[model samples]
Target chain A: MLNQLARDVKASMSIYDAGDDKVYGLLAEFAHPGELLHAAEAVREAGFRHFDTHSPFPIHGMDKAMGLGNSIVGWITLGGGITGLSLATLMQWWMGAVDYPINISGKPFFAVEPSIPIMFELTVLLASLATAAGMFALNGLPRPYNPLFYSKNFARVTDDAFFLHIAASDTKFDRDATAQMLEKLGASNVETIHDHGVEDQD
Target chain B: MSTASTDKTLAHLADFHDEAPLVKGNLTFHDITEIVSSHTEKKTPFAWYGAFSLALAGLMLLVGMIAYLFWNGTGVWGLNNPVGWGYAIVNFVFWVGIGHAGTLISAILFLFRQQWRTAINRSAEAMTIFAVICALVFPTIHVGRVWAIYWTLPLPNQMNMWPQFKSPLLWDVFAVSTYFTVSLVFWYIGLVPDLASMRDRAKGKLRKLVLGVASMGWTGANRHWRNYEKAYLLLAALATPLVLSVHSVVSFDFAVSIVPGWHTTIFPPYFVAGAIFSGFAMVVTLLVIARKIYGVENIITVDHLEKMNIIILLTGTMVGFAYITEFFIAWYSGVQYEQYAFVNRMFGPYAWAYWTMMSCNLFFPQFFWFKKLRRNITFMFIISIFVNIGMWFERFVITVTSLHRDYLPSSWDYYTPTAVDVLTFVGTFGLFFTLFLLFLRFMPMVAVAEVKGIMPEADPHFYDHEGDGHHAEHAVEPSTQQ
Candidate 1:
């Protein structure tokens, strides 16, 4: 039953492919951030989930307009920090109390006061590392390949231009209709991007 | 209030650039990218060669000093029985304190939404990493057996022994190492977007390949940005506490001891404040020369320099208060050893060092109270150098003076740095500048993506709603596009 569902989704996705090549998505460019933001709102209102806006920097309120929930990176970092604190406490206690205990100034073996600094340092260390790692993992970074790279117009997205791309994998994606809707919404350039099988070429 | 007066107040508040532009020049997005990237992409300037040569020579000297110290042992230096922690400890604390300004500017100011940091954060973060490198040299070599430095870590071995967790020295190891790791990651994560920009613009095959790998395929995808922003915020939050703790741990090294002058309740806050004061002074010294050499006068403006001087003033005052409070506390306690330590610091053999610290840190920054002097480039430059020198002396007086005249009069002797001691301290500068010059030559000195974000033209609502003249050329007419 799962295989059938997967096949059905693939069939629907192929309908937007147009058979010339495996197109990645439709790329739409806006002259200003307001237009791009509005277009993102329109795309979300139209029930497209697998779409994103590209700009030189993050636009305030753009995430809300795009219907993106708050990121989970913070929660992951918190978890990492707690784990670090517990690990540091346990390791120090085990070393001092159980492993090879020796008397130092007749103090208690598992004193909490002196261990606080190491625990604090470890917590921060692990939290920061987890934040970086989680961000990269979520972003699917270091892939070094994307269909967007083939679009000459999309390069400006890191400069002055703002863009919104609707992936063909979206359930409602129809290439011609998406292009028209983007143009109607004041996109300056609406270009259909092909996958071009660059990954295979490499 | 009258409506006319209310309107006037609002108008005044809206004039964000009534003074001068934070980033000077009518800069387009392309212009910002080109201007910053040119420093890396263009031919290596002759001026850079001269500076790098001097730095390289210093680096060689540092190498020689380290080799000699390692071969002959710590005895070659002026570390007698009483003054065991002499120049090495002083230089270590000095360099470590110098590293705080970078994290404070990049992480703390960023969290505060200080947009001006974008113009200088890149270079400042690089300085933090290099300064920490220079700082690490002292602790490593001070171990006497440099090859056995790993024993400081809590590692399991055949001997079945562990580091003393209760010791402040062990805490220092963990704190400093963690601080270094977090600062490095924060610096690199911040560099990703700019690295991607460089990768996109690179024409040479080698340059493109190198930057492409370094950027890790950052396409500025909005999904990636969502995670990136979240991670950046988290790192900044984590670093804020880490910065405070790292310096506090360094202070604990002295404060936890029973030594009369070192055992003080105010040491943590005082050390942290002095760290920030010295760090800012170093930033100002480097930035003044950098802006002049790189011709980035417009981006790193006098306004930025004035703001930095104001910070120096605030922290410097805090340090001065700490100094006075220490004396007052010693007198109030009525402890002879503590009283003597304070008096000896001012009038004893190391009186010169104490006065130098006072004049440099407390007196020199008083000039910044005058806005004209703060804004004057040459005056600010001279004052910043003085502050740097003063901060070093502050550390020297703290570490050496306290040790030179301990509880026992029989053991007490006047401490002096040998030629090797002076050479080693100067060599660390060589290491710092060599790394810093390489960073300046190859890396983007200003964060390009962040600067573009602050431009009014980048905002869609800015052109349509605002009446500001700064972005007049780029503001699109609503009718034409609509």
Candidate 2:
């Protein structure tokens, strides 16, 4: 009974199995950004949650069409900026006032007036770094392995082509039904893509 | 899709505004990708090789001169009693000023939603990073002891000596270093999507591997782009004030001091204006050559150059006004030392330098006010070169003139740069150009994803709402239609 349960869990978690030549998902190519956007809205309305649209550039209003909300990157950057400000202030106060104070023209130690420049610089630097890192982390980037790469036609997604991908892991995914829906929505081509599985990669 | 159909959609969009198209030639996204990527994918051109060789030679000269300077000392340069600061400080300020134009275009103009910046922001940002590197070399070597450079930082030494936080020079270390780091991060973030495009279109394993690593497997997912765009906007917001603060801090290095000509409240704004003026001139100088050689003139159009020239004219006028204001204030203050500094600058040994600065920075840019002159490629290019020369002299005049004639008449002397000083300054050019040439050779000089984003075809409603005669409410504003 335990062995059967283990097998069932493995099957449910396996989105793709290259060893068995298992299908990954349906990859559909659209003619342009407008078609892709509309198709994404249709797929969302059709009850598919595990889908994404791809284009060479960010299409304005794509997030709305895909049912995504405002990104949390701004809050992340603000947190980072506050952290930077606190650290800069503490470091300056500790060093100048507590640790190794110096008397320069009788000016007070650890004054805020003179420390504003460094404080501002650190805030900007940390905020920028946090923004970039938060963006990458939120997107789950550096994920070089994706089933859509198996489609040769998908190469143009970064050039001129637009694509919509519906993962097989979706509970509503019916292979034939998904392909047909994509075709009806004006997709120029729809193909089943697979995960060739992991190998030695750079 | 056919080019005609794309043009038709673009024309429909243009009905909102009478402005010219930002991207010329009615090129498609594929054409843009092909044009930008082929420079990296194909074999290197002879012209590139020639330019690289010359730049490499200059880099070598710079390296050798630094080695010689290290062997000797700061005394090797013409550092006299009063004019202890010479070519080193002048060159540092000059190069740092040149770096400002890049950040201005990439960050400030981005915040303003200037669509034309898409054509030149990538290369301009790259130039900013390289120019900062060159600017840094002088300060590092000028300390006369390269190995002890860590003393400038607030590291915990055995002696427990922390950097004096009150010093403007220390403020400079933090400000410039912070500027360099933030600019680098900003530039790299912009390059990721373009690098991903290069990766997808790549042929070789090594090339693919390198780009794959650099791009972080960017797939242009809407999920990713949503976050990416937000990050880009936030970074632009952060960098705008940071750019302004950087030049202001640099001006503080002089303004906070008790020097007769340097101690003025006007230095910060004046310095910032001059930096932008010189930076725009430098960008114009480089883009004119780069676009012609790479056959990307259609992408980076004459309209872009005309816009940049207008900025140069505006900033040049501001700088000239500051110059006049300085003289007037010196006379009105009735401080004999300050009054003498201005008189000496105009009629002193460095008068030639001051007038050269006036002609290049103040006089030449006035011609750009005329539409024909602004649009004339050869004329603008010449004016850009003159502006570069004039800005350099501006720094020289400010640094040398104030110091040469001290309050004590006996210490007044005419300062001259040795051959070492002159050659070391020239070598910095080599350092700047070598990095720039390598960048042009390997990287996408134009931001491909950004340029595509601005194209008419990238609009979501361009195809869906066509012929309905009712555009979406979120359609690009008429003012930003370009």
For model 2 chain B, the run of ten residues with the poorest summed lDDT? B473-482
Off by over 4 Å in 2: A1-21, A198-202, B1-18, B465-482
Give the lDDT of residue A150 in candidate 2. Answer: 65
> Candidate 1's residue-wise lDDT over B120-196, tens digit each?
88888999999999999999999999998988888888788888888899999999999999999999999998888
Looking at model 2, give its docking quality level: medium
lDDT of each: 0.85, 0.88
Which lDDT value does model 1 have at B378? 94
Every candidate's DockQ is 0.49, 0.49
